[model samples]
Target: MIHTDVTEPQDFLVALGGNMPSEAGAPGDTLQAALAALAEAGADIRAVSAFYATPCFPAGAGPDYVNAAARIGAAMTPEAFLALLHRIEARFGRERVRRWGQRTLDLDLVACGDAVLPDADTFAAWRDLDPAAQMERAPETLVLPHPRLQDRAFVLVPLNDVAPEWRHPVLGRTVSEMLDALPAKSRAEVLRLP
Candidate 1:
């Protein structure tokens, strides 16, 4: 029988990270398995960045993290895509024990084309939150382009690998530009995993 895929595909930027071991083994191995699971769940795997070894946020909270980025083409709403990401994380033994706490897997929906998941004002407020205020809380829902995407080296460095030119719909800066804008030390902290 002749069949054609009818789902409307949209570009998606997903950030993957973890510091703890899982059923798949090491953090890096777990991430690889997560990618395969994403593909199996119907994300059209377009490109993936090399993994990077990054110091944990908050400096000395836990073990170092293995981080990476993936560019996907998928036919799903941003909310649906985010839900799928959560499901994948759950499959990999992810647990939300604490904010910024280490885990077995983290699949973050960094961006979904130029579409904003909630609205412009909420997105802007979260994106522009003061560092001190940010530590006090987390968004209750998915935030597109990730609220802190511009400030995180671990996310930006690997993102530059597969989608250096992808612009932040709200910030209007390319991934490469965002990576360059980070403080020298922050940028230096992300070492490519060999």
Candidate 2:
């Protein structure tokens, strides 16, 4: 297991996503409340991307999703921070019924200050896993700089808004660069939420 030395108040990138309604209201409103919850939970929110409307990943799994990204400073270990995110999801009534299923809120820890949890080799293997394999299983451990980030326009596009220069620890590509590398259609699918 590999671990990076973490400094106090490390920066973290969190991906926000949801398609279902909750006590907090619509998906976009739920995301806004989630951000506020993060701040209440001791996350010093540095930046947040504008909300984007993205089609459901499975092409009909559920309603369109509201997606965004936020940069935050936190004084907690990666694992602990992830736990906090999960707790917030639970608060918003998220369920783990199916992979990539609809949800009221989904907060994914995208990156933590260039910190590579577990190890680089494991991260690479997961990052390169075939799409079919991805559908069959999820990573057992957290993968920093999120393994599939570069391939998802929903993530990269919103990340570009807040952290255009944030470099992927392993890929070494900036968010804007990754966003530009995506096919035009993938980019076009992420429309700003009105």
- The clash numbers for all candidates, in the given order, read 0, 1
- Candidate number of the best lDDT: 2
lDDT of 1 by residue, 50-125 (tens): 9999999878889999999999988777777778889889999999878888899999989988877688899998
Report lDDT per candidate. Answer: 0.89, 0.90
User: Each candidate: RMSD to true structure?
Assistant: 2.8, 3.4
Q: Evaluate model 1: give its TM-score.
A: 0.94
Clashing pairs in 1: none
